[model samples]
Target: MKKFTITRILMLLGLFLISSGIHSTNKESIFDNIFTVMERTSSAGNLPGIIDNAGANRGAGFNGRYVFVASRQSGDYVYYWDVTNPDAPVQELNISGIGGGTFTLADLTAIGNHVFASNMVMPGIFKIYHWNGIGAQPSVLIEYDSGTARLGDAFTVMGDPDDFAMIIVSQHGGKSFYVWAMENGELNFDEPLVVTIDDLPANANFSRVTLPDGEDEFPVVSGPAGVFVLGEDEDIILTIEQSFFPGWPMYVNIFAYEGGRYFAFMHVKDNPAANVMYVLDITEGEDVLEALQILKNGTFAAKVLHSHDMGSIANGNASVSMDVVIDSFGNLWLMGFAAGNGFVVQRIGDAGPDGLLLPFMETFDGEGEDTPDTWLPEGWISFTLDDDGEEFNWYWSPGPSANPNGQMRSQSAYQDDGTWYVLNPDNWLVTPQIYMSEISGDEIIELSFKIGTGAQTPGFK
Candidate 1:
C-alpha cells in the first residue's frame, strides 16, 4: 500500500551521519544553511538558521542550553538563545551593556552560568555576565581592564573555578600581552599579572617548538599568547602557532585537572615532519603556574582531524583558531566562532603520540587524520593585476551570491565571508597553488576536472 522513496531514505541517512560525527562537507551555497550544528557539514535537508547583524560576528559561546552570540550591532549587546530544543531555538534575551560605555564585544566565551566578553578599546576591558539559567535575566557580574593589553582575543573560560577566564592579548609590533588570568568578580586598581615576553630573563626570543627534535624556527618573542611557557628557559613546551604568522590559528585548551595534575594541549601545527600535539602539565593552583612539563604519553592533543573549508576571506586563513573542549567521554570537540573555523569533533585514543584515531590510510598514523579527497582539490582563488601590475587586495562581502547563503565556491580561497575579491573585469581569477607531486613507475598521469565560465563573455578564463 505504501511506496518507499530512495530520496526519503537518504535524508534520514544524512541525519544519521551527523550523529556519528561525520556530516556533509559541501561549500557550494554560502549562508544556505547546510548545517544545523556548529560543524556545518553540508546536507540537502539540514538547513542552518542565521541571525541578522551588520558587520562581522565576533564570537559565540554554548552553555549547554543557551547559545550566546556577539555580533556587534548598533550597541553593546550579547544575544542569548534558548536552545533547550535545538530544533527550534528562540532568542530569549538581548542582554546589552556588554562592553559598557560605547564599547562593543571584540570576543566572547562562556561556561555554566558565566559569559565573558571584551572590547578592543585602548585600555583593553573585559566584562563578565552571569545568569540563573534558562529564560533568566542576565547581569554584569564583574568587569576588568588591562591598560597595557590590546587586540584582546580568545576569551575562554578556564573551568578550574568555573569563574575565571584567560584572555590572549594579540597585540602586534609589541612584546605581546602575556598569560593574564582573572578570577574574582571585582577589579583591583593595581596592575594585574601581565606576562611580558620581550623581557624574559633568559633574553630568549625564540626556541625550538617541538622538544628535542623539531627544526622549524618561528619568531617567539612578539605577538599573541600561543605558547604557554612552563619553566625558566622556555624548556618544556605547550603552545599554539605563534601569532606572528598573520591569521595562523592558535588553539589552547582550558586547563584540566587530571590525576593530581593540570594539563592542556598546544599545537606545533606540523605534519609529515614533526608531532602536531604538545601535551602540557601546568603547576597546581590558578595564581601560580610553574613551567609545564611535556608529557610524551599525552597523545590526546595531537589528533589532527580536518574540517570543511573555514571560508575565510583572502585565503588568509591557514589555521582556524578553534576553541578546544575535551569532553568526559574522551571525545574532543574543537569549536569555532561564527566567523571562521567550523567545529570539528574527534575521538582521541590512548594518551601517547597521535593516540588511537581511526586511521583511514596507512601513511597517516600517529601523524594525523587523513583528509578525504574532494571533487575540486585545488579550489578557486581570486586574483587581479592592474594595468600597472599591482595586485588587488582582500575585500569581504555580505555574501558571494545573491544572499548570504555562506558559500564561497569559485574564489581562489575558500572565502565565504560574503566578500568577493573583485579583480579587473578582464584580469584573472587564479586558482589555488597546484604542483605535480609524483611520477609513478609508468610515468603516465591523467588529470581531470570540470570548469565552466558561467557566461559566454569574451576573455572570461
Candidate 2:
C-alpha cells in the first residue's frame, strides 16, 4: 500500500472533482458556488449583542446605527450597541435612572434622533431624549406628563424616520391607545391622539359581524386596542374580547382605516368553548369552529374562511397569528406556528380568492400536529433554480444529514438511491389564499384542508 494521508488524497482529487462538477463553473458566478456562515456575537443566545441576565429584555429598537435595549420593569439598566460590524457587535452604552419611583423600568422606541422611553410609575410620563447618532448616551429632550394615563406595555414608532409618529397603548389599570406625532426635536401635540371605536369610519359592514356560538350581549370593551399606523394616513387596529357565547368563546377583531373608511379585514372568533366556558346548552353541534372571517371594503358581508389548527407542540398550542411585521415596501408579513415546523412566514397583499386584499404583497410559530412527521422542526420546499416562468430542480432540501426520513417535508418528495429527494416544486407547500368562484351571488371560496393563510392579527394571541 502506498503511504498517503487524507489531506494528500483530497488535494489530488480536487482537480477531478472540479472537472465533473454538478454545475458548469465557467458560466456560474462566484456567489453561486460559495457559501457563507454568519458568526454571531451576542450577550445572549438569541439576541446578538444583548446581555444575558435574570431580567428579560422588554423592548428593542434601532435608531440609525445604534440598537437600543430596554429592560423589564425590574431591570435597572438600558443599553445600546454599536452594530457597525454586525459579525462582532460592541456594547456602546448602558443607562439607568428612569421611572419616578423604585422598581419601575422602561420600554423604549426611537424616532429619528429621539429615543422615547415610557414608564408607568410615579410621574407617569413618557420621556423623549436626543440621540445625535454621534454619542453613546442620550440627552433628555422633553417629558410629557399626560395626567395619569400610563403608557405602559405596547407601543410602535411609525411613519417617515425624520418625522415619525408613535402609537402608545397604555394600561394604567384601564387600557387606552394614543397616537403622538414627532418631528425635529419636539412633539407636535400637547398630548397623544386617543384611538377609540367611535373614531372608526362608519360603514354598513359592522352590522354583519357575528361571534362564536350565538349568544351575544356585546362582549367586554377592553381599553387600548393593539394599534399600528401604515404610512401617514392608514391606521390598523386589533381588539379581542372575552365572551361566554359558545360560538365565539373569544373574539379577535381586526379593523383598518384608510381614505375615510374603516374596513373589518378579519374577525377570528376562537371557538375554544369547552376549554374556556363549559356550557351544556351547546350540545347539538361541533365544539370548535376556530375559523377566520375576511372582509373587503365597501362590501356588506364577510367570508368565513377555513378552520385548521397547528395543534400542540412541545412549546404549546399555536394560532393563525403568532407574529406580524411590515416590510419596507409597506406589505404585511404574517407569521403562524406549526407543531412540527418552528415558524411559517407568509406575505399578504392582493386578495387571493377573497377580493378583500388590495394587491399587497405579504410566517410561523405553532405547536406540533396530532401526528407530526419525523418529530422534525423544519420541513417544506424552497425554490432554487429559475429561468423565467420555467424552472429545473427548484426544490431545496437539507438531505439525509439534517432530515434523514424527510420529516415535515412535502408529499411531492420521493426516495432516490436510498436517500430522500425533492424532485418536484409543483406540490410545494405555500399559504392558502381566498379564491372566489365566478358564480356571481353564489360565491364559492376555496380554502385549504391543511395549510392556510389569514391575518397575523394584532391581538396578543
Top TM-score hit: 1
The whole-model lDDT of each prediction reads 0.35, 0.32
After the best TM-score superposition of candidate 2, give how far the Cα of residue 113 lies from its true spot, in angstroms.
4.9
Clashes of each: 22, 29
lDDT of 2 by residue, 1-461 (tens): 64332122223333112111111122112112222111121211232323332133444444433455555534455555533334443554435344453224444555455565544443356564445553446555446665665444434443333543333343333424455555544565656555433433231111111212121111112211321222112222323222212222211322111111111121123233111111011111121111111121112222222122322222111111122233344333333322122222234342233545322111222222322332334534333223342333444445545545545443334444656643433222233232345678667433222222332222110
Ten residues in sequence with the least summed lDDT for candidate 1: 359-368
* Candidate 2 global TM-score: 0.36
**Against the hidden reference, what TM-scores do the models get?**
0.43, 0.36
Highest lDDT model number:
1
lDDT of 1 by residue, 21-109 (tens): 11233222211322233333122222223423213345566654356666555545566654323344445354644445234655566
C-alpha RMSD of candidate 2:
24.6
